[model samples]
Target: MKRIAIDMDEVMADFTKKHLALFNADYNEAITLEDLQGKKLRDLRPHLVDEIREYLKDPTYFRDLDVMKDAQEVIKELSESFEIYIATAAMHFPSSFTAKYEWLQEHFPFLDDQHFVFCGDKSVIKADYLIDDNVYQLERFTGEGILFTAPHNIHEDRFIRVNSWANVRDYFLK
Candidate 1:
């Protein structure tokens, strides 16, 4: 069976709002991932990074994360045809990893432990296809890339460009 790697944040789980909320609450300043790209997490004022680390350590934050639209259906359909694996970035804290796994179990009951891969980098994972929101990750994975669109930037290219899970399924069919 073909092995497919899927991203968790933004693609499967909606974490932007929760992340922004926590950042604002901790730093008393509104900060987004887009703003932190060039800047270092340690340099952020009021130590927002510390709070973010704490948030990751707690599994409750994962409970607030919602699955993307039609994600369940697409995942189910794809899993039938391919060896679906949930490949996600590791949490900053060790406990956060466990929380993330638990969160995945609770939210995505269809996924099995063997089908999950928790790692800091996805380039090491072997797969036939990688579906992710981050362009860098898609570029790194040694497989066919399916770029998922986000609010900040919409990547338009020859490779798969999908706004929703329905589009993703249609793209695969074609």
Candidate 2:
């Protein structure tokens, strides 16, 4: 079976919403999703640069993430036809390793233990297709790259874009 690698953060997990919620709570500001879409937390508000990074260190940050809509359904369906592996760059936060693993187990129990691959560089991962929100990961990948839409990668046109899990299902349906 053709293997497809998926990302966890903004791709399958709702990273933006969680990040923004924390930002809003801490800054005491009401910001729309569009305000920070396609821009990093540091770029949008340099004042919260340290606080933003500090949030990642908190276990609650990774453990309390909301799963992307339709992500579980599409990934489950794709797993039946293709090898589904969760390839994520998760080495930055030492506390995130278990938090992320537990989160996946709770959210995507259909995936096997072998399906999880934690690494900083995705170029080392080999698969037939990679669905990720980070363009740099796609740039270094050898296989087909499917860009999962995220604020930081809105303008990137290097790879086919999947706006949502429905788009992912449609892409492979072709």
Candidate 3:
């Protein structure tokens, strides 16, 4: 079976709003990761680190993340023809990795421990295909990328530019 590595944030889960809300609650300001260079979680202001540290302490924060539209249906359909694995950049933080894994299990009961992989860099992960919203990650895994577009201005140009999971499904089916 073809091995497909999927990103959890944005692709399978709606993290943008929740992440912004978490940051706003912690910083008392409506700042987003886009306010930083690279527009990534790791590029946030140094002062935001403490807030992030505190926010991640709550297990419910990760557990409450909403799954993307049609995610369950898409994953179920894709899994029938591929060995699906949930690989996410959000899993890089050691403190929240375990909780994130637990949350994924609870949120996506169709996925098991063997179907998940927590990694900082996806370039090194072995996979026949990878679906991610981050342009940098898509560039890193270009040969196997199925880039998922997001509402971020920074990555608007770099992602493969698909609007929905149905597009992704069609790409692979063809």
Candidate 3 stretches with Cα past 4 Å from truth are: 24-54, 57-59, 153-159
Worst 10 residues of 3 by lDDT: 33-42
The most accurate candidate by TM-score is: 2
Q: Candidate 2's C-alpha lDDT?
A: 0.89
Q: What is the TM-score of each candidate against the true structure?
A: 0.77, 0.96, 0.76
Better of 1 and 2 by lDDT: 2
| Cα shift from native, residue 19, model 1 (Å) | 1.7
lDDT of 1 by residue, 1-174 (tens): 888888888888887767677768766876777765534344565444565566667656766687889989888888788888999877445555766787788777898888888887789889998888777777788899888877543534645778889997887655
lDDT of 1: 0.76
Q: What is the lDDT of residue 97 in candidate 1?
A: 73
Candidate 2 lDDT, tens digit per residue, 145-171? 999998888888889999999999999
Please give, for residues 17-109, the per-residue lDDT of candidate 3 as tens digits. 787776777667767545643365535667566666666566566667888888888888887888888888765456667667877887778
TM match of model 1 to true structure: 0.77
Clash count for each candidate, listed in order shown: 0, 2, 0
Candidate 3: residue 79 Cα off by (Å): 0.7
Query: lDDT of each prediction vs. the true structure?
Result: 0.76, 0.89, 0.74
